[model samples]
Target: MKKLLISLTAAGILAGCSASDSGNGQEGPPETEVKTEEDPVTTDYLQERFYEGMDYDAYAVEIQTWVDKGQASISDTVKIEGQEDVSADIIQVADGFLAVANDSKEITFIKPFASPEDAKEYLKKNL
Candidate 1:
């Protein structure tokens, strides 16, 4: 504000002394044009088009099946909580019937399989 007042004061003083072209004096620098901001357009797009999907289920099932085969080398040590470690024995049982541990008692039938939908269906049919 002080600089502006000094500039206007200098402009006023300079205007009185500057040489006149046709006895009508015009002095000081030309007026600068004030700039205004434009209404900006949004540039983001909803979707990108440069990607592809690959099936992982085939690989997963193949690996699981390979591991399930009896030809796979068996490991020596199997860990269990509060019990002696025993070699993992893949015992076959009826569908939707799984054997899970219950403390030191013999492995008993754990009601409700891993899949709730399958368990519900089994219960509907059997129970």
Candidate 2:
């Protein structure tokens, strides 16, 4: 009868609107976009007391000048007495060497002696 036909039509409509039928005709759940972030660069001072409040960029340029002038050479690492071996760029000055951290660009240690023998003597007396 008319009621039976209407019931069938309604059932057909309900079936069409079921959750399984995505309007886009795709199967399963929709994919979401994922975003990733990078780690931030950090700068720190190892010996803050020796920091003369100079601009880091200027200081770097000055260090580069020393390298250019053959007054200093960059080394991969420096070993400090009574301290852990540090990964740094060693700068040789007239008096001693300056241990600069590679990542932080901070002066980690300042030795006011020209040679290893002088450094040993100084460390023996001081520490």
Candidate 3:
């Protein structure tokens, strides 16, 4: 009975130690990999097409804010409260304004510029 008890106690201790051991052979909490806001994972898709070094998220947020306020609208022609008339329905992209219209049954990719002003100017002059 004494030998059986000793064996059981030894097994329990070993099991407990292994359960708490960090895979590095050290006993304690496992190491965790931490990331910061500047990390690529944190930025996600915003990494592409930055404006004045700002991420796409910030730019998109600004545009969406305007849209929510009824300051911006996208349709056959984009109408911004304070900006000039846009030639076609404009979708804000990381790079610039993209003309979008549902009338055409074809897919089209408008070349994006680097600034919102450029998009507005393009619309004013071209469309």
User: Which prediction has the highest lDDT against the true structure?
Assistant: 2
lDDT string for model 1 (10-90, tens) is 998777666454356533322222222232111110001000121223322332442354222212112343345221112
Candidate of highest TM-score: 2
RMSD of each: 32.1, 19.6, 15.0
Ranking by TM-score: 2, 3, 1
- Which is better, 2 or 3, measured by TM-score? 2
Count of backbone collisions within predicted model 2? 0
Model with the higher lDDT, candidate 1 or 3: 3
Candidate 2 per-residue lDDT over residues 24-121, each given as its tens digit: 57543222212122321111221322343333444566556545655555543444445453334445544355545422444433444345455544
TM-score of each: 0.16, 0.33, 0.26
Report the error of model 3 at residue 54, Å.
31
- For residues 1-107, what per-residue lDDT tens digits would candidate 3 score against the true structure? 99999999999999888777744563322222232335421112222322232333344454455456444334234454433422234554332355432212322
Better of 1 and 2 by TM-score: 2
The Cα local distance difference test for each model comes to 0.30, 0.45, 0.43
